[model samples]
Structures are given as structure tokens and as C-alpha cells.
Target chain A: MKRGVFKRSLDSLESIFLFTSEFVRENHVDPSLLPAIDLIVEELFTNMVEHSSASTADVPMEMSTVDGGVEVTLTDEDADPFDITKVPEVDVERAVEELDPGGLGLHLVRKFADSVEYHYQFSNRQARIVFRKTAGSGGDDV
Target chain B: MFDLERREAGEVVLKGRFDAAQREKAQALFDEIHESVTLDCSELDYISSAGLGVLLKTQKRLLAEGGRLKLIGVNSHLRDVFKYSGFDRIFEIEPG
Candidate 1:
């Protein structure tokens, strides 16, 4: 498993990408999976930075190889419980004029990852989001 | 590393990743486009929802002004993103 603690800002996205690249290379993850992994990580991290009122400056992330896939865990410390899984579904079928950009990031996260799970620790005010993407398993059919 | 450039012929070319960090730069470029235009995404490797948001905003604005944004040279992976996000219906896309 590889771990990284990133600053709570959009600028940290570059660092996050670098960390993800290193993890992918080190773990021998499939190169085809890079885009999906990158997309999922970016959406989740962006959510934490924009929505989670976390007081901590560091957002910890962990990535590891799983059977025919990769797993990632992100924790937002000192933040309120925002169950990302509970976010209302975005109506992608909505007309262009009616479509709202809000929630689109989370929507994509759900569509690209094979599985998404959320856990919150009340005592510590921490939100942990874990998602997995398996080889040959894009969430297109989900 | 994302680059958005407007060529002298008036087509906008996009290359590299377009994520949250590149939103402001993309928006600045899109803001100046008021008429119908083609966005050449042949070199665009990846795009997140933040990037999608910029495109949606620009498309909407253009539509309001009786114009549209046509996208060409989109790879299969990006086409999937558009299909999953329902953005395929919002813009005219020609696969690369």
C-alpha cells in the first residue's frame, strides 16, 4: 500500500495525480485503468476540499493493489459527516438548459468506480471514502 | 499539463488533462467564445467533472446566444464519459 497526505486545496490535485501515478507504476496496475482511477480520485478529493468543512490541512489517501484491480481510501479529518453515497442522484438525462453542474463530480465518481463505500467516525469527525476499480470493470453498465 | 488554444482558423484545441485545477484557465478561454465553434479534442487525454462543468457552462451560454459548440476527435474513453454523464446529448460530438 502507498500513502500520501495532501494539502486541502485544489492546487493539491497536481500532487495527488503524481502520487497516484507513482502508486500505479509501483503496483503494476494496468495502464488502461489510469484514466478511471485518476477521474475517481479527483472527484472524491475535490468533494472533500469543496464541501467538507474539515479543519485539518492534510487529507490522507491510501492506494493498494487488489485482485485484478486497485483500491483507494481517502479520509477527510475533522469534518462533518457528509455521506457521499447519499448524495441525490444527478439527472444526466436532463436537457442542456435544465442541467445543473452541481453534483456532477460525485455522479461521475459513482459511474466510473466498480464500488464505492463511505464510513464516518463520529468521535473523530472523520469521513472515510473507499472506492475500488477492477480490471475490465468500468461502471458504464452500472 | 492542459493546454487550451484558439487557432487562427477559430477552432479551439484542447490537449492533455482537464481537471479541477485547469478550470479557471479553460473558463477564461471559453468565456471569450460567443459564436458557434468547434473544439478539437483529438489530443485531450482526460477530463473530470470539473472540466465537464466548464464545457457545459460554455455550451449553455452559446446556446442562449443562438450558437453551439461542436466537439470532434473525442477518443472512446472520453466518449464514454460524455455518454455516462449524458453530455453526449448536449453537444455534437464526433469520435476521433
Candidate 2:
């Protein structure tokens, strides 16, 4: 089951969310769980574009619904084997001035998703998340 | 991503949504400023955490060089985000 692949860009985010949402909403997907999907996607996908494409070069991104959940896998040739789960958490409550908004992207992904896991094979790193259906949940809130 | 532009009065105005895609370009624009930079955040309708990250980094860079990141005309919504993130303690945000 192939989902959809998008070029790394800001304009593509809405389409990605809408496209995934449409697919999820039409079937056995719950409504309360949509925002989580969108948020995690934005957080992870945004990092891919920024750190990979923004600094390096054009990268490949593919997304699909697998195992009864939405999966977005990004492939970046020569990308560092960075794992989002390994990054340290940002102390959002700290008093600071002009601090780089550090640690928010991956932080949001982990906070909103039910479960997030990472895999690396052949130099490609993938962050996979699963959202469980909890009575009234759909990945479309945000 | 955001485009940092230097105005005539020493203002570094950014015009565009600072998302994943525009990040590199924003970095390039940020490199051009040598002093205190006033970022135009009015047209900025939405900012992901990634954008926020870049803004934070850029602010740090400018501040370390005896410069600063001043935001002008930030909408109430984004202002709330800045406030919520406690970024208000970092950057000098002025109402436009």
C-alpha cells in the first residue's frame, strides 16, 4: 500500500495533511486522532526538509497508511543517521533570551503521537508513529 | 523558511512563511545582517516549530555579535505562541 510522496516544502504540508486525512477519514479512522497525525507529520517532515534539503540537497519523501496507521518515511541520501528520539528535551519553562527554539519539533512529535519508533537501514532513517483508536480519535485536529 | 531583507533604516524584514522549505533561504538571508536586525513578522501567518527553531537560532547569532532580533507587527496569535514558548523573554517584540 503506497501512500503519497511530497517534495520537501512548506506549501506541501497542507496538501499532505488533507490527502492523508481524506484517506483516513473515509474508512475505519477515528476523528479525534487526526491532529496528532498532522502534528507529527509536520514536525518530522519539517525537520527533514530543513536539515536535509535546506542544507544539503533534494531528498526523497514517501508517506503511506500501513498497519492501520499513517506512516511517513523520508529518504535522504548522505543524510546523517540522526534519531529524533535521541535528542534531549527542551526546558520550555526556562528563562532565556534569544534562545534558538531548540528541541520543539521532535518534542511535539513524541508528545502528540501514541508511540514513535525509529529504524535505520542502508543509511536511511525513518521515524514511524502509531496512533491507536481511542473511542473518539482521528488524526485531523491540528 | 523566511527571507531576511535589510531595509533602509537598518531593519531586517522577513517576508514569507518560515516553514521547512524556506529554512535554507532564511539562513542565507540571516547571514547578510551585521547588526541589530528588526524582523518583519507581520506577513508571517503561520510558523511551525521548525520555523521557531530557526528564529531562535538567528536571534542567538545576532545577539552574540552585539546585535539583536527585534520582531515588529507580530499578530496576536503568533504573539501568543511566542509568549507561550517563553520566547517573549528572548526577543524584543514591538507592536506595529
Task: Using lDDT, give the best candidate's number.
Answer: 1
Candidate 1 lDDT, A12-66, residue by residue in tens = 9999999988888888887678888999999999888888754756899999999
TM-score of chain B of each: 0.95, 0.84
Question: How many backbone clashes are present in model 1?
Answer: 0
Residues B9-92, model 2: lDDT tens digits: 767666655666566677666776777767787776555576677777777777778878788988654564565566777878
lDDT of 1 at A120: 94
Task: Report the lDDT tens digits of candidate 2 across residue range A1-142.
Answer: 3356666666687677676578677655654455455556677767776666534444344545555465555554455567677788767766555244666777656555555666555434433333332222222222
What's the number of clashes in each of the models?
0, 21
- In angstroms and one decimal each, the interface RMSD of every candidate reads 2.7, 5.0
For model 2 the local lDDT of residue A75 reads 53
Model 1 misplacement above 4 A = A139-142
Q: Each model's fnat?
A: 0.70, 0.41
Clash pairs, candidate 1, are none
Give the CAPRI class of candidate 1.
medium
